[model samples]
Every structure is written in C-alpha cells, then in structure tokens.
Target chain A: MDFSSKLLEQAVLEMSQLPGIGKRTALRLVLHLLKQPEMQTLQLTDALSNLRTQIKLCKNCHNISDTDLCEICANPTRVKEIVCVVEDIRDVMAIENTGQYRGLYHVLGGKISPMDGIGPSQLKIKSLIDKVREGEIEEIIFALSSTLEGDTTNFYIFKQLEGLEIKTSTIARGISVGDELEYADEVTLGRSIANRVPFESSLKS
Target chain B: MDFSSKLLEQAVLEMSQLPGIGKRTALRLVLHLLKQPEMQTLQLTDALSNLRTQIKLCKNCHNISDTDLCEICANPTRVKEIVCVVEDIRDVMAIENTGQYRGLYHVLGGKISPMDGIGPSQLKIKSLIDKVREGEIEEIIFALSSTLEGDTTNFYIFKQLEGLEIKTSTIARGISVGDELEYADEVTLGRSIANRVPFESSLKS
Candidate 1:
C-alpha cells in the first residue's frame, strides 16, 4: 500500500471510500486510469461531478431526474390516476423495463427499516399522501419487496389512507414462471392458489 | 437498461468502463454516490483528475513518482551499484514491502511480449542497457514474474549484457513459506529439489 506518489495515494483513498471497493481494488482502478489517456479520466470525473451537483429529483415522485418532473410523471400517456409505489430508482427502472404497466411511480427512496433507522419521515411518504389527498389518484399499487420492512411500510401507509377514497393493492405473489411447484414457498403457493385467476382470463398475457 | 435521465446514463456508462465493473455494478455504485453528499463525489473526481494529469515518472527507474527521481533511487543509503530489475512499479513496491532488499530498482514498465506486439523498444530496456554500458552498475538482479513473457524479456536483456562486466542473477524460486510441499506444483517442487540450499542457510531467516 506504499504508493509512489501522494496523488496516487489520495486517489486510491477516495476510490476505496466507495461501498464495495477496497484499497487494493482502488489502487488497481487508479493504475488502470493512469495507463489510459487523460481524456478518459477527465470524462469519468466530469460525469461523476456533474451527476452529484446537477442531478435533480422529480417533485411529484422523488425519482432522480434532469428536471423538476421525471419522464414517467411528465408523460401524458402514463396513467396519473394509477400510481405504483416502490423502493428506490432501480425498481422504477425494472418496472419501466417490463413495458407492461403504463402507470406513474412514487419512489419511497427506501422502506421502513427501524434496524437501519429509516422511517416514514425519511422517505417520500408525505408527498405521496399529499398527492392522493389532492383527490386525483384513483388507485395506489404497493410494488415494494416482500421483506418485513416492505410490509411494514405498506401497512403504515395503508393505515394513513383509512378514509381516503382510493383503492390500494399489492402486486401478486407466486412461483416464478420457470420455477417448479415443489420448490415454491408455502406462503406464495397458498396465496397463488387462493388468488387463482379464471381459466379464460389467464390467456390474456 | 432505459435510463430515466441522460446524466445518470452517462455517469453509469463511464463508471462501467472501469475494469471488472459491469453495467449493473456501475449503476449500483453511481446510485450509492448519489445518496451521499455532493462533497464526497467532488473529492473523488478531483483526486482522480489530479492523479491522471499531474503524476510523474521517475527519470532514473521509470517508476511512478511525484518528482524527477523516485524515493528508492533518490535515497543515498540504497545501494546504487546493485539494482533489482522488475517489470513494473508494483514489483518495486512488493520487493520494498519485504524489507530485505536495500538495492536500487530499474522498472522495465512491461515485459517483451511478441504476441501482444510489445518489444524492447516499447519498454525501458534500452535505458537499462545504457545504464549498464555506463560501467557504474556492478550487479543486476532479475525479479520478473515466472511466466513465458518474463523469461523472454529476461533472456533478451541477458543477451544484451553478455559482454558487460556486471554480475547477473535471478530471484530464487521455491515453495511459498506457508504452503505445503505435497500441494506444490511440479515445476516449482522440482526446481526446489534441484537447487536445494544448505540447511544452515535455510535456517538464517
């Protein structure tokens, strides 16, 4: 770890500060950058700095955006009345990739995890509640993970919307498309059986 | 892979360009950075850009440095006559970490790899030969890796120094200190047997 230059050491230290990168990996990455043209390093640095300083969050849904409104929230074709709620931007991207749903999104930023000190106040729950209270949203879909924290967040929000004139539902749980029936968890298998669709309706997809 | 914003996409693309980082990992890293304070990203970007643009190579040893001469070559206590020739700065650091060698170093930048179109001219070999021709170097130790490329580079340099007055040697190859003999590779085990050292010399360390 004895670097030849202070600049190299500083670079490695900063790089290793990233979540999963260690000092050795940081050193390797920095050395790789050193081997490339200066333009590559400049480009990388510029992108990172620009992202940190100039990136904006959507006012409506709390998703990262280049403007006040995100693409999904701004799109006229997307259903404004049907909002799918999820944790973080990755889920939004995942749902967007499916091309199956045309609804808007409300990113919670994170679920309610008391172990991690995150609660409703730390998320975008208030803004979502405000949007629903404005009486425009007709249905709210809970598309969060099936973890304990996810359920806790969903229940917390559901309690807040007790008298609101909106329908709320969770995404369906079942065995994955290619999974064997025997391998499916008991809870999922039971739910899949209870929520079984009519034989003709299953042919729509 | 449809990004919500152009800036996010650009940052992820640049990050994924790094070795061992894929698009998914790049997205994760970028998102982690986004969640942190802007100052952290600015510091990292500054360090990277500075390291790439301002770093220098030592004139004497061709190792990375902040000045004209590297620390090892600049030190008056290090033996100037005895030089350990290595493939790159990493080897120099590795040998320095051992705390056994007190000699100067000559970094070749890279080995002579014909398959990769790398030749002596592409490396610091000519400067090494020039140093030997200067008649100041008394001994040159080859500390390159145990690969075919390493051997080809060593042999090529050895041929050039055939008529020189300097003594030439290579680092000893044997079983690693903590490794079991039964698990040792055949080539290394055979060489260890063929070049067995005196029992008293083995006990010196």
Candidate 2:
C-alpha cells in the first residue's frame, strides 16, 4: 500500500514484522496509536524497551525475571528439590496457575525441534542436568507438551541423568477432566487406559 | 495470568492496549519479541517512537503526511478544482491505489456520529467549505461509507453548500465488482437497482 508519509510506512513495516500481524493489520494498529494520546505511544515503547534492556533470565532455571533469580526460584516455600521441566515461561505460568504443583520450574526455553535448528544445546538442558548431578534436585518431572520434539527432549534429558541418583517422572496424559470419553483421541484414550491409577489415588488428588 | 517478571507484565499490558489485542495475545507477542534478537525489539520501538514524534499532518486535507501539504495536494498534475471527501487517510490511500481518481482529497478525520460524541465542528468540514467559498473547487465528491453517520455527514455538508455553484455527487453504491447477486444485501441491491446508470454511460467508464 502507498503511504503518504515515510514515517508511517516505516512504523507499519516494523509492526508487521511481528509473528501474526500483517501489513494491513499493522497499518490499523499504527493508525490507532496515532489517533491516541502521545503518552500512550511513549508508554508502550518505553515498556518494550525496558523489557528488552533490563529483563533478566533466572540463573537457576532460565525463566524470565526482573532480577537475577525469578520469583519462584527466590521463594523459600517452593520445593527446589522437585524441579518441573517445561518449554518457556508460558508453560511455567500455566503450571503455576493450576495451584496444584509447588515445585520449582526448569524452563527449557524451547523443545528439541531439529526442523527449526533448535537442538539440546540451544535449550537450558545442561543447566538442569548440572543441577541434578550436583545433588540439588531429587526429582525431575518432565512437564513438556506431548509433541514429538517434547518427547525427544524429555528422553534426551532422561538419558543424560541415566546413572544419577535422582528419580524421574512425567506428567500424566489423560482425557480432559470435563471431556466425554467418545471425543477423546485414540492415542490419549489408549494411554489413559494403559496408565490407569487406583480409584482412591484419584480421589486423594 | 501471573507473569514472572514486572517488565514482561508492563510490556504485555501496554501492548494489549492496542485495538483487538487481548492480554494473552499480548503476552505471546511480547514473549516472541523476547525470544528474538534484542535488535528487533530496539528497531520496533525506535520506528514507533519516530513515527509518533516526527509525523506531520497535511495542512490542506488533514491527511497524515511527512510535509505541510500531502503528495496528492502538492502534485501539479492532480486536478485542483475537484476534491474527493473521505473519512480518514485510509480512505485516501484506498482511492489512490485504484489509480482512477485524479482529483485531490479532503480527509474529514471522521464522520459525524453523535453516539460517539463526534460532531461536524470536530471535523475538517469548515476548511472544505472555505475552499469552496473561495471559488477554488468546482466539484465535491462524497466518498464516505454508506452508513447512517456517513449519509448524515454528507447531507450536512451538502446543506452547507446549498447556494454554491459547484457540482456535488456521491460515490455509486452497488454490489461489489466481483460479488454475486444472490449474496448481495437487500439495501445495497435495492439502491443499485434504483440508481442504475444508462447502458452507454456504464460503457463509457
């Protein structure tokens, strides 16, 4: 599209560089910012700049943080010996929202996706393994998604801790709590049946 | 959702302020930026800041521009005596892309919508009238949308120029060029039939 101003075109071009935003949507967003108070634009840019410049990664688990260690890692109440392994901070937030698990998280940053050129070295797998080898963590729960890359990353880490004294486990795969049995996919349904737990154990949770 | 970092929360909060963007989508976009190189975030913020700080509005048409007068208004080849009235710069760009209109544009900024607290006095309608009164314009084309607010704005401007000698016309409302007749809405179909042009006039265009 022909923009009357170079500044507008530049802004839209940069805005469209985002993952899901297109040029037209970027134009609409930029025009919206133009129509709003100047303070809105300033605040947005300032916040983004501050995030990129000043944000930190938790030294312990690689999760995003405002300080050297994330809130979960700094909290003494969280169980540091039982580390939940997952991909990125979104997963960490999802698990935290559940209020079920009190263990600390080890953010892998990403899965072992060879197609995207992301391998074991690109993630925080080494740090997690080092923590386990140092005898700081007693249990490692694989909380990654059920995708092939997730399984591959989990198996790779499990193999790294082969001779270690730490106990390893994975989050259970099952039909959703409220979903009907008929709608469940075959793989998940089969897994749920194969890994059936005692009725009293389910009630305890 | 609980964000691990204050900077991340602030960035997501500011990003979500844009139209149509929700908190989850904002978090995703912000996290995507975090994963990318820091330079990407810097460039995006710089572009937005530059656009907001340095952008200019065309004095003649009120369209977004990099100069005092817009390109269309500055171009000597464009017809100076005919002006197409639009609601905003988006309309100006849309018409310019068609490559059919050679006349200049007058961007009204917005329509007269009482529900939105917008009125004639808030738009650029006065400047358009002033230009017409100075005998600088021979024709005024209403290219606003076909909504009630658009028609009200058009009729209000039409009344203001009741005693003027200049010709006044509106863009033809019809089924879109490639649209099927069966899918056409009742109001547009009726208007298209009532305002059907002569066969020779249609062929001339």
Candidate 3:
C-alpha cells in the first residue's frame, strides 16, 4: 500500500512499534480504524492518550491508579497485616484472581537487576521497606518470578528485613491447578509435591 | 487483573472494539502499551487522533488524502486515462503496491450491500459517473474483490459505463508468485489467464 498520508503513516508507525505488529499489520489496522464510526476510533485514540496522561502510580503500592492511593491500598476489607510483595502489578493481579489472597499488595515496580543498570534503587524497594518497617505487617510473601533476578531481589529484600519477625513465603512453581494426578508427566507431578510447602515456614532458614 | 483504572479500562474497551480483537486480547494490548515508553505510546495516541483531524478524502477520486487531491491524483506521471475503480482506498493501495499499474484511481467508497442498507446513494457512484462523463478516460478498470457484493457493485458500475467506450477490466487472480509452477494445478493457472482480458471486451458485451 502507498504510505502517503502522514497521519495514516504515523498511525502505522505507532502501531508497528507494538510487539509482533509490523508496518503492514499496522497499515491494515489504520485502514480498519478509518472504516469504523468516529466515536469508536476517537475513543481508542483518547484511551491511548489517557493511558499515559491520566494514570498515576499509587503512592502506597505503586500499582497504576488515578489517585495517590490505588483501590487495593484504599480498601478497608483487604488484609493490611499480610503484605504480598510482587515485582509488578501484573503479579499482584495474577495472585488476586485466585480469590485466595485477601492481603494488601507491595509493587516492587521491577526486580533488581544490576547488570542492566537496574538496582534496588530503581525499583520501589525503599518504599516497600518503609511500608514493612511500620511494624503492622505480620507476613511478607514474595511473588517474584522464577528468574535469576527474582532470586537476587528476594535475597536483597530478606537481607533488608533482617530484624523483623514477619513470616516470609513464596508461591509454588511446579505443576498447576486442575492438573490430573494420573495423567501428569513424571517430572512435573513429582516436582509439584516435592517443592510444595506449608506456606508459613517455607523460604526460611 | 481487575480493569479498575479509568484510563487502563478505557484503553481495553477501545481495543476490544477492533476486528478480531476480544476482551482478553484488548487487556493484553493495553497491558503491553503500559510497558512501552510513555512518549512512544503518546505518539500512537496522537497519530490516531491526527488521522481523524488531519486526514480527508480526495475530492476528485474519493481516495483518503491529507489534502484536496491525494498524492496519487496529484502525481503527473500517473495515467489518468486508465482509471482503476475500487471499492475503497484499500483496494487502490493494493494495486499501487503491485507496481504493475501506473494509473489514476477512483474509490467507490463501498459496495452495494442491501442487507446492510448500503445502496448506490451511500457510495461515490454518482461522482464516478460524473467523472467518466467528461470523456477523457480510455480504460476504467474494476479492481474490486470477486465477492457477491463486490460483483454486484462492479455490475452496477459496468451498466453506468454503458455506451461510454471506456474499457473496464479486473485484476487477475492466479497462483501466487513463488508458488511451485511445476507442481501448479493446471485448472487454476488456466482460469487465471483466461479470466484476464483486454479492458474493452470484459465490459463491452
């Protein structure tokens, strides 16, 4: 297709920047948007503009929010004594969808990665430490990924929480929910129960 | 994740309205947008908004343009005598990309879909007829799809061009390039060449 119109070309350029989307796909999407009613297309444009302009980081947890406090932080029913420390809000949502954790969230923003110029200072680690130091939290759960950076971040946090009696734990990794015990692959099933913990004393010395 | 943030929710909602995009994909895209640089995301938003604000249809050919006449229409090298009639600008672009034609184009805006309440009045058929009546055109090629509505629209245009000596033809569909010619099915290849004729005979009788 002729990429003539600057706005059309720009839309394609912007869309191509997205993962897995190329210039051709972006062009198709732009053309598709052109055919749609004005409101729908304008809404998408407004939504994109607002995604950056309107959304702010929650002061308490750093989860995306419009105000200083995210809904999770402002909620009274959520258990504040049990803090779930996650590398990102995505992890927080992943845990929350289980309907299992009623605890408050602590968004680290990112895992500590020294090689990539990302350190604890880059993340919201100081804020998390300050939240924990208030002494109201009873448990601090680590819900970082199984990556190397996740391990290092966990250790760093544990070191920082040195003098605290708060219970430290992590979510299990092997197998998954609704797994068939009989049909389970040997390594997967064996590792699932093997790595299973009591959720209280696990990840502790 | 809970789609609670107004901007995030709006982004998701807008994404969901796109063709082939569902709620899950919308959420994924919105979340992906969040990971991109703030400036990059804003560029896309601005581009989309600019498309509506800045882009306009060419008054002559009805093709999408940033000005009164599209670049294709303004290009002196393009053969105005061989005007390719398409259902939309997308069709015009597809032909342009083929690099096989050096002709001007006329966008019909849309096809006649009575079921969807689209009729001759909804399309740019009147504009096309008026342009053809000027008698400068030698060949008026039909580059619409072979779909039911596309054929219907083509037939309608063919009738309008009746007694006007301008030849009307269509883009030939064949086994794609790079496809194994030796392994090629003779029937499809034969049909391809047979269907392709000089612009005159296809429309005349």
* Fnat value of model 1: 0.97
Q: Rank the candidates by DockQ, best first.
A: 1, 2, 3
User: What DockQ does each prediction reach against the true complex?
Assistant: 0.92, 0.89, 0.55
TM-score of 1: 0.97
Q: Write the per-residue lDDT of candidate 2 for residues B129-169, one digit (tens) a residue.
A: 99999999999999999899999999999999999889999
Better of 1 and 3 by TM-score: 1
| Docking class of predicted structure 2 | high
**CA-lDDT, candidates in order:** 0.93, 0.94, 0.81
Worst 10 residues of 1 chain A by lDDT: A1-10
lDDT (10s digit) by residue, model 1, range B1-205: 9999999999999999999999999999999999998999999999999989889999999999988898888999999999899987779889989999999999998899989899999999999999999998999999999899999999999999988999999999999999999999999999999999999998988
Chain B TM, every candidate: 0.97, 0.96, 0.83
Clashes of each: 0, 0, 0
List, residue by residue over A108-193, the lDDT tens digit for candidate 1: 99999999999899999999989999999999999999999999999999999999999999999987889999989999999999
lDDT of 2 at B110: 94
